[model samples]
Target chain A: MTLDISAIRKEFPILKTSIGKYPLIYFDNGATAQKPQAVIDCINQYYQAENANIHRGVHHLSQLATEKYEAARGVIKSYINAAHDYEVIFTKGTTDGINLVAQSFGKLLQPGDEILISQMEHHSNIVPWQMIAEERGLQLRYIPINERGELDLTTIDELINNNTKIVAITHISNALGTINPIEEIIEKSHKVGAKVLIDAAQSLQHTTVDVQKIDCDFLVFSGHKIFGPTGVGILYGKEDVLNQMPPYQGGGDMIKTVTLEKTTYNNLPHKFEAGTPNIVGGIGLGKAIEWLSQFDLEAIAQYEQELLDYATEKLLKIEGLKIFGTSAKKCATISFLIDNTHPYDVGTLLNQQGIAVRTGHHCTQPIMDFYKIPGTIRASFSFYNTKEEIDLFIGALNKAVMMLK
Target chain B: MTITEKEQGLIDSFSIYDDWMDKYEYIIELGKDLPLISEDQKTDENIIKGCQSTVWLAAEKREDKIIFTADADAIIAKGIIAILIEVMSNESPDTIINAKLDFLKEIGLQEHLSPTRSNGLVAMVKQMKMYALALKMK
Candidate 1:
């Protein structure tokens, strides 16, 4: 069950490109993953063979289109192990999904209700709630994280109290790579009768998610992070909860019957989905899920964990490189800043040698604020990534540091 | 051609880090060839606010096309203005509208500019396009 990385590498065509006469070593999986050939071909096949509007027509192409679209939904249902396909709503991506919940569910909250979020959420998760809290008079609270980027869950009992209505948190930290105790967070929120929303953008790629098993009221993730096309994602909400909430956008497909008198909305998932959905993207996502299904999850996890351990040990040996988020339960992401070298300069120098690592606040500005530094160069990994790539990256980084000095 | 041989030579020397202070002396040397904006044309309406460096852009119609004249307080900003003028000047409304402006990427300038500076650059480009669009409407 060990991942055949060489075989996997062959599936991605972009890896062939060289930078500065060196082969490209992409360690920026936290931002987005490189798509496999199957996913790319699926997208291409849809455009080539089955280009038609879905769900509204009874013609042959449209019927085929609708069947394929719904089939993708079924794939997603099993991918996340949702109770039913009805729970999975297609979205633009994680940002749109979070915004939908915030706008629709946030409308129901009154002045005294509280919404709790973690300090490590990406701006995508934080800003939507901030907007909702401002519009409605609800108080927004934060579950603080320790120096290691692990949540201080001891205070969770006090944080989720009578007034708490919704608890939204990231399943995995994009900046620090700390995998939050989302199942425990969900349990605590449910105890207070609060619905929970998990941002599974980072976690969905590295780990398996079962929405029914986690019992989270809502879970969202983007497809691009999991080797699918961009501009498509899944928002899985319990059927009852989705039925209760109002429509997020008013447009073409999210309607049953419309009149000037009154407009009746479509069913649970469709109500949230408006306009022309990324039909081609949905097909690509289904192909990506199929690609991932070929591998054993346990094997993937073990290999990734070993890679992380190896990377951590090697990266720490380098002088003046301070690794952030030394938590025990972290994904294969390492964020570190070199002594006296600005992250941008390091990133530029690394790029010259074909080592692509992300260098910035990583859209978690508050985390940067807590550390009192501008940013760090983050190297995130996938199961397909090998130790040799890490060695190349490390060597380039060391050379970058020496050259900068 | 309104541009002097020296100005054309400066535009030819445009590089990615040409905006850096040390590199920008070459741009001020280029600005010496530019026709200064008439004092009467330097009105509030022509001013581009919120830039770190002051920039003024003015437009005139010639042969049913918009001709843009620009000046900036910073030498590099003036170089940016020069770059914009090179791409956009003397072009017809439809031609200006159709141009892809992919040279920004080719020169590797897009990634180096801060978000604010990029936005300012975008605003300048957008303003020039707006002039073309206005001409087309008339």
Candidate 2:
């Protein structure tokens, strides 16, 4: 591995914490990753030394805070390799980011225009467009998946007609762990004059993201998923698209000028960043990106792929343990169900052994509904997660399955 | 038998286990011995949707008493429901409706069998009581 897994584990205090008698074997990285000391310390240091409202304040502390906050925006912009800093708008997380686009972009759509999403999208991605559809008299389409949990892009021509105004899809299926062919899909949508919004909440943590390369009109991801603080995220929009879209919220900083008679919205990023932003969260996210930038994500991804492969092989050995997403080119998450076993029982059993695996639809109900299962025991891995942990996870899962069955 | 007495009996039975692992095993054993619902009775209408699993519950009134039968796709959930059924089945509608079921806390199964577990415990309890409520109306 390009990164030292043991040393990396030392950076996260929660990883060493014991749950009951057993040391914590955290396999729920898909839900949220444990934060490293650097990100934690960054937030602490911000609160300790630099606690001030940003932008408007001329005081020394406020200036310092504003500089740090805006600098973090630049870091995020470059992190995603967006063409301009203005393209990156700070958001609550992926949900808020997508909602920003849905709400703002919804205003631009005429009746009869369609918003196409995929079967594998999380509820957050699906519901927003559905809301827009309900409000604007627009049609909502689904890009269905094949038996292997991969999107059937071959059917894209039929799905993405001239009526398609926006194609919103996830870069990686949060529930299925399927790495979607986003670039090809983007090209397909663009051919039909549809703006594509990529939900990178799952993929951003696992792989390298270059928004410029993808050329998706908008991209959204959460900081917490990538070893950063919660309540902070990025919504990267193309400069022209963001400018054309109306402000997502009306509050301080979003406006350039306001009056009893009229109000004018602020430029590019600020128009969307309404009210005081998650100041410490922004600073902490910058630190997280800085810490993560240390390793080649390609290397980390390769290592994680190795771990996914190892865990898959071991998990399949357990009788009646069936994996949900068997897409050939998927990332490092395995959603599985033991024959006639409830995921809750298995997950609770794993928790007893201090192995943390998420047991629910993972906010992707349609995928679960598609699989005809309530939920699956999802064991998601990161680069720091080891083959040894996978072994323990497998062993614990086996025991849980035995008891459950 | 009184509901409190039944609850007390459950608490007394579970008090032997010192840890969660042993407690869960006992629950599983109870689940293994549970009389399952028939295929015909395992209809969509009888199913309680859990986020983690599917639970099927059916209730019939045996004269003045309520008889509940349940099965779960997950073993632990089935075991948990089995415990509920063991204590609650064949009880009077009033007794089933009035039972506090605080024995869950006494047995430390509250965390395991969470009432907020809309998919499992809470939904099971609701379905069981609905059966009682329906029978009481009849």
Candidate 3:
């Protein structure tokens, strides 16, 4: 099965818009995917017709809004193939989800216990654990990545010992585009009774993510990264695991009873969801997922792989250009640098040509330090992107290099 | 030239290039031609750290006029610094501080000079004024 590239491109209205004199060639999907018209309409309609505070109001709008929001949760639960709908918790984004686990689940760890993360894990995944470790007198360790940006699994035996409490790793490297061997990592970590958290912020849009099949203890992803609205994301944990942890935040909807002295928390998911949620954002995300469910994800992944290969070959032909993250098993993201040129310079010139790409350390400073480079210019592709856009990107990049050099 | 005259000179010079790339070509050349700050001056104290790029600025006053020297690791940032120096360097403390540098917008380079760019140009401009004020007070 093949994806209709043109049809997919048409669904995203922003793709047709121009930036200044040139048409916007968006290659920053790894940062945030452009929204489809369906998702946008869903948000507008929610506010226009069904605006109400959810879970408490006795009004008709509140009941309708609550139904839609919970329905969204069900969609996400099935999307990730979780065991139960109540296991899916809404968050501000991936960063919020990680911090929730670090704060709530960190209570379960004893002093001198260990938390394992990778060198390529985003700062969101690393800093929360570091904070918890520092507060708890726990040891924080890292799994190293080799020259190809693939995790060095040779040391996994020593790393995942009995003291290891949790292994938090990214399913895909946002900077390097390396698809991690997470299934193997999960198996190894669980052998010693350590739970695993998969940062799937970059995976849900590009590949299939199944929580039950992987049997991950916790999985997190942002709604905006998957063509949904911002300010909403999912934290999928096993029902048993989430039940073991305490409620993350305290406020309106997450409680069964509240008193001046003591309070009993609500059930599985609502216990974590505190305060008035982003009601419209959740419904928009549901629409976005429903819109995506029509397409064959496997076919989309295959098409993006071809695009990555084509761009890599063309980019390598340019002299003095070095591509980072050469992992054979990777996504359609590309990070590179030309000679001694700074990424900011190249990125600036590309912007002038209306080619949107990300520059700088990409919030993975440890990975940048590992590569011994300040930063790299990252051009991340999506399913709607094409070879013609890659050609334009290559031309713009050549011009940027010429001007900078 | 007076600061206003210098700004006008830049505006006039940039007006010839209708294309953004051509304007950047001129800016890159100016960046290359910017007077180098002494290696000793490129210390942590002199550095304005931007998330994407770093800029080192040093200044001293001779008579009533202050001379500013700056450099950046990224050429685009350096180019912006060069444009700023062209207007603010060798000017009195009050003139340097009060200068609007509106020529940046007039030349269609305001986006590059925004505080959010985080390339240190914004902080460098403020530091340049601080150096002038300090020298004037002394």
Candidate 4:
């Protein structure tokens, strides 16, 4: 089924806003996607109607809330094709999920065991591994990226030796928009008996992620980035893998039984999930995934590719605009710099023109270092965004560039 | 001019430009006119780490007057720091210490800046006050 851009845009209230005198042209989807009214209403409906804590209370409201929360787990499990709902653990966000793995699964690693990551990973992916490596006395290895910003996979054989315990990588580069060949990485890593965690923070919104098909041992994504509420994300671990792992945090709802002397953790997913959980946030994420699942993702992807191609062609025609991450397979994100212009200045000028773009190292300082620049002006898109918006962005960016120069 | 008068003058100058383009141009010109910091003064210690831009600020006390110089990697940020230095520099330690940046609000600057740049503005002000507070104790 073909999509209606205007109709879809109408679903988001914030899209109607203006920056100064100009209409808002939001291109910072990489930072966060604008929440659709469906997601917002789901959150509102939770607080307004289904307001109760899950998993503990004997009240009717608590039972309804528990049903809704677990139903969300079922939706997410199907969305990713997880073997069981127990494999999907609710988290604060992608960063929280990564830390959970680094700590819980991390406790299992031994000295001389290595963890492999790519240079394009966000700080969330890098710093946690470093912390755990130091604590566990494990070695850390990096899969270098080529000049095109794609991961150089020729040396995967060298990096994924038998000693490699876990190989963590982003499914798509947040900074460079490089869509990694994770299926290959999973295959190679598995052959050497290594568990792989996919940071799908940038990829989940753009395309479908089938965890079962890919057979990744672990996967992480942010709900907010996928048009859900903030403070909630999903951490999918293989059932067997999670059973072997220890709990990341200690709190209510995560215990089977507790005493002053000892505590036994809860089973499966709840074992990793602690505290009250982001009750409302979980409901919101479920609604978002439900709303998105209705559409043919292939249709949405094709339309988005058109926007990407159109924006790329138009942006390239502008003088002094050099786009980074010229990878053949990428999403609708373009990180670029004007000749001798600071990205901060470019972003500022664009803001005055009512165009919102992200400016900085995008939590990928190593990518910036690779490009030999301080930072880049990143313009990313979602399916609801139109070619018209991209055209306006092109015009505004051109005007901003001319003025800055 | 007194720091207050200098600040008022800046506000009045900014009010002349009806267009944001012209206002930013004026700010850029002001940045160009700032008493630039020397290369040696642009050390890592002097750098005010901003998420959007890198700002380097230098301050010294001659008698009771505080002399300040600053630079930024981004022109817009440089212009912003120029406005701060124009008012706070060459004022007494007591005045600098108690200085209110009401001028930024008055000229619609603080609210106009992106979150990152506004945070950098706060950092610049904080560093200047810290310098004044240290010298006042000495």
Using lDDT as the measure, which candidate wins? 3
Docking class of 1: incorrect
How far in Å is the alpha carbon of B100 misplaced in model 3?
0.9
Ranking by DockQ: 3, 4, 2, 1
Chain A of candidate 2 gets a TM-score of 0.99
C-alpha lDDT values of all predictions: 0.83, 0.88, 0.92, 0.90
Off by over 4 Å in 2: B32-51, B58-67, B89-99, B113-119, B126-138
Looking at model 4, the pairs that clash are none
Candidate 3 docks with a DockQ of: 0.82
In terms of DockQ, the best-performing candidate is: 3
Candidate 4 residue lDDT tens string, A1-405: 999889999999999999889999989999899999999998989999998999989999999999999999999999999999899999999999999999989999999999999999999999999999999899999999998899998888999999998999999899889899999999999999999999999988889999999999999999999999999999999999999998889999899999999999999888987789999999899999999888889988899889889998998999888999999999888999889688888888889899999998899999888878988999999998888889888888887777777
Off by over 4 Å in 3: none
Scanning candidate 1 chain A in windows of ten residues, the lowest lDDT window is A340-349
Error of 4 at A359 (Å): 0.2
Q: Candidate 3, residues B1-138: lDDT per residue as tens digits? A: 788889899999999999989999999989987877999999988887563787888888889888888888989888888888888888999998788888888999877677887656677778887888898897
Q: List the residue pairs that clash in candidate 2.
A: A342-B74, B50-B119
- Poorest lDDT segment (10 consecutive residues) of candidate 1 chain B: B16-25
Return the TM-score for each candidate structure: 0.79, 0.92, 0.98, 0.98
Model 4 in CAPRI terms: which quality? medium
If both were scored by DockQ, which would come out higher, candidate 1 or candidate 3?
A: 3
